[model samples]
Target: MTKAANFIWYELMTSDPAGAAAFYGAVVGWTIAGGADPQAGGVDYRMIGRRDGGNAGGVLALNADMLAGGARPCWMGYLHVADVDAAIAAIEADGGVVHMPATDLSVGRIAMLSDPQGATFYIMDPIPPAGAEDMESDVFSVTEAQHVRWNELATSDPDAAIAFYRRHFGWGQDGAMEMGELGSYRFVQRGDVMLGAVMPLMPGMPAPAWSYYIGVDDIDRAAAAVTANGGTITNEPMEIPGGEFAMNAVDPQGAAVGFVGPRGG
Candidate 1:
């Protein structure tokens, strides 16, 4: 099936927006812009933009009202779908559950969901996308604009999860990356470029979950930002077999995040 929507925005609902903002800002060299005013009940969020004016992302304040409403600290990415209603139906038919029904935001219509294994994401209609290219510009930076780029889900059952996305998102192409000890990661692609990787947990990992990546200039310094901002370094910066560098860290809210650079970001 055709990938009608692109993931344009990712809002992490976690405690400590200020700290989260600082962590991500330093890691990705992202500039945090003014957010919507507070008196209106909107989040004390920030617009995360690439340093070189490449692309823009978002951040939100995680609060008690959110957790009280069953919200967990997690990364929520938005998929730009042409028809949000149809996408919602497809997800439901494919064993996913809709946590929040289709709701129209100032941008477009969106519906939050969880895959059969509980990985969460949202299907939406982006407000003013020129096309996939512009949507990509909005979703991630230029260096990150691949056929399918951004969020990768690490699951317990890669094969089954791949089959699920194939049916649900109808991805046209894909390939696999062998992560020495972890296992072979089968990517769900929109075309030639990999949108995300479906990695099965190696051992002792309780459940399948999703992790997000942001392109940066320096992984070493970025990893340090995690610790500086009251976060924990899950994985130190290391050179992936290929020509890239990356590190994994836990945000203040305990959500996992990854920072990738061209060899040494």
Candidate 2:
């Protein structure tokens, strides 16, 4: 079983599920399948399946009720926890806020939460299917082409945000990169694996949030697909530390997603 405090599941809550499916399907090469989730009162819920086989994430359509309540299209990260209630208590004590209380579900207990610095994510005590391995083990691995490659946070207070997560998820600083006037980009780890980094939010960016990078085979091709499929490339493709190229984009429904891959012509 995968240990607690690791990223397990991902979800995109969008106003236009079909549009999101179409846009992401072309950009990331994911096949959107699956029917409505019965537990969700038969709301249209789709699975993002990778080309190599296995689910990457899910898409949940935001209905009129959700939109009326101010729900917007966004990608949410799920961090595994051993006890959702206990985690909630710790989070509250550490200046975090609960957007949704812990609730029972088919998979496990889950709660929507925002860290002290206001980056939203979920904490789930996931229940793997019968005869299956830990959900985290199957869903999150570097070798998988479509897996989430990184969890990047752009926040107003990186130091305080890193400290809050270090206490909650046992994430530690691995290294730091000086960004001159923008301050430092600090890498974070859960044990020995370097998951991602935290940096100060760029001016004019939306409120503090976590941006997940999806792995791809070619960065330039994916960026082009993003624009061609009705999405906007918010940032030009750039080289990262491990020789990978990456870029950020907004889907047609306005959800932010990142792509990481080799440079393409």
Candidate 3:
């Protein structure tokens, strides 16, 4: 199968790795393990493992150097591309900015980037694991709890954002929803699979950003767990299409996140 240009990994950079691990484990039901190990360059990096199997993402210790450099507690998505250098050039040509140029890592080459609207993410050309035929799928199905279920983008210029991605990543318009005064909610897809949507940033929203939604078994229960664990529920569970519910929230370390699942409250 041809590798699609998609989000291949997700990560959270936070000031309190232990606090974040405890909070998200309770809220998302992920098994957080390993910390301050010599294996991770001795930087206190930890893995966010899903209950079902495989790693869901990672949590990196936010150090003083990063904090001095204006880095805050935030969630970042790593996009998979065939060529990192080529993707960087395309991004620059499209009015996007490159925060970090392509650099080699143990896993692959990565470049930190932001859209024309200033929504930051990573673009990477990953090295396949030993004995694996190909890189595992990064985005997960909606039916599975404890995995990424949706990818959403809120940009100042939705039309321009959509065009930029389509031009660079080969994404297509699957469908759209009219949002009255808020403009159109456009669904973006690769081939027949709908990955996510782009919409105009609502008033009071920080910067143009991508919010990933993780699947949960019970929306109400998860929302409660979020609050109980020191995370804030920014948006309560609300019904969406297909009888599932969705919500917006902030993790304990302050990374914005989303959740989707069956409604109970």
Candidate 4:
């Protein structure tokens, strides 16, 4: 990971990779290309808005024949770390488990981990794309990491979650916000910018699931695009209490994602 501690790849493991890529393209106006574009590669691995030959992300084909090891369809976030092995060691030492040991990729090494609370994510140490400069970025690029604004972990215990992150990454909690119905929402900041949240899961929800939010230019248009693209619209377009208009949607692969307009400061 030659870049800062920022998110790199935003992968979606789904039943049909091709269809998923098409769905995202229609909904987000992104030109799904690279291996994700079946015309470009034979494999099901596909990408959206591919340019500069960076390893941003793609939808992995998980059809019945392809699906194995009981991996459910979900949106996964991959952060660029300095060292894959070191990150694995830190994750396990912080009460996490190595869900997937370090695996070698053409670009770099990757490994998946789940915190003690069962929230799963991955870390990657990219090889800088051979002759390329770097794949990571300093500021969060909304267009690059599509459907990924912040990486939030809904832990069973917020206190323990904060402690674990602090011990592992030196990040601290930025305090909390109380939604009318969502109740208290704790904000976590890597340093100054609010990276994401650590909220309690809803009733009967899975324990400690990690989800990423995609920032959009217009919430209404984004939600409309979801339906137009053959994707399922989970939440109708609506304005939150603070004038934040958003809509929830799931790609063709059944990975839930949300699109929000400009967020008020």
Candidate 5:
């Protein structure tokens, strides 16, 4: 089967890796392991493991040099592509900026890029482990708890963003919801799966960015946990179309994140 351009991994670049790990562990119920080890390129990278024994994503500790270079704490999603070099070239031709040139790693060839509207994400061509060639990534799921359920893009130009993503990644606009002055909330889908939505940047959103919403068992409990752990709930938990509640939050390290689940009584 041909590879589809879908988000296969999520990552958090934060100043305090240990604190961010603890905060997410309490709020998202993820067990983080692996720290800065000289054996692993001396990078302070930790793995985010879900309860189901699958990896949700990873956390990379931002160093002083990264901060000096204006790298802020943020959550980034990696979209798997079949050809990273071709994707990078196409993206650049379509007004997208390539922040990091395509480079080969032990696991894959990857590159960092931003949409025309400045929403940043990564494109990776992953290499499966030996004998696991047929294994699919479960880091993104629409209903499973602890996995990313949604990948939302709030952009300065939704129409152009949609067009660019569709042209390059084969995403489709399944439908849209009218949001009055805030504009339309356009749902994006990859084949049959409803990935997430795209909407205009709301007031107080500093810039165009993507927000990955992780699935939780209880929305209310997660919202409370956000505050109890020094994180700020930007949007209160509210019912979405599918009867589940969702909320936007800012982690203590200043990265924006989201959660979606049932609001248990």
Candidate 6:
């Protein structure tokens, strides 16, 4: 049996690449490399390096042409699939839209897509480097700092979104938390690893989208770094069921993100 698809990579599309690099570097303790000079004028793709020497993701500079074409600052994840074309077909048949058709790059074959409710993400069939065929991606982790710890989707339709993801990615609704009038926060999992949760859009959420939570060692210090670096804390840190605190914030360039860590006294 083939292994199920999982989110293997993440990228941030931002208008201010230099500023964003600085912001995330301070907040999440990431090292930004490449494309330091925005005025140099090329495809500005900066690699996000974790302290442990692993790459967490990348930051893409959105050009004027892209901005005019309706591109905005946002964080998108790449889901690794067995076949890119087959995944696109399955998505379209289930009411998802193909924003960018499958294109081959040095990294792999990838396509950008939006779900039935308009949450955008990418599907990739990666071509690993020579002698790295057996290597697994560690960009996402549940307990490690400086990695994506959770993937939450706030959509307009919870039931349909859950069903669609379940059909395509083999995600199971293992449990949920009742949120009074807001509805249930449904947790999604693949085998024993809890990926994240899906729920209806809250009152303050701008639209239907996926918000990724980056893990930090200290929640309170991370929140302070966000504001000090010109980012805005949208949701203050609050203790979750597991005793850790989760908070939401928008980057200096306006991309919404979240952080999960311990609230050190």
Model 5: per-residue Cα lDDT over 123-149, one tens digit each: 998999999998878899988889999
Query: Per-residue lDDT tens digits of candidate 3, residues 34-55?
Result: 4764546667678888876788
Cα lDDT of model 2 by residue, 72-138, tens digit: 9999989988899999998999889999999998788999999988999999988888977543455
2 versus 4: better TM-score goes to: 2
Give the TM-score comparing model 4 with the true structure, all chains together. Answer: 0.82
- Best model number under TM-score: 5
lDDT of 6 by residue, 124-172 (tens): 9988889999888889898888999999999999999998888898778
Model 4 per-residue lDDT tens digits across residues 16-62: 66677677666555555535454424556766553344434666777
Local accuracy by lDDT, each model: 0.68, 0.85, 0.85, 0.69, 0.90, 0.90
Which residue segments of model 1 deviate by more than 4 Å? Answer: 34-43, 129-137, 141-149, 179-182, 263-265
Better of 3 and 6 by lDDT: 6
> Listing every candidate in turn, what is its Cα RMSD in Å to the true structure after a full C-alpha superposition?
3.4, 2.2, 2.0, 4.0, 1.7, 2.4
For model 1, residues 78-160, the per-residue Cα lDDT tens digits are 76777878878887887889999998866678898888887888887767644543434356432562111356787777777
**Candidate 2: segments with Cα more than 4 A from true spot:** 1-4, 38-41, 133-135
Q: What lDDT, from 0 to 1, does candidate 2 have?
A: 0.85
Q: Quote each prediction's TM-score.
A: 0.85, 0.94, 0.94, 0.82, 0.96, 0.95
Query: Whole-model lDDT, candidate 5?
Result: 0.90
lDDT of model 3 at residue 167?
A: 81
- For model 3, where is the 10-residue window of minimal lDDT? 133-142
- Of the two candidates 1 and 6, the one with more favorable TM-score, higher being better, is 6
Error of 1 at 184 (Å): 1.8
lDDT ranking, high to low: 6, 5, 2, 3, 4, 1
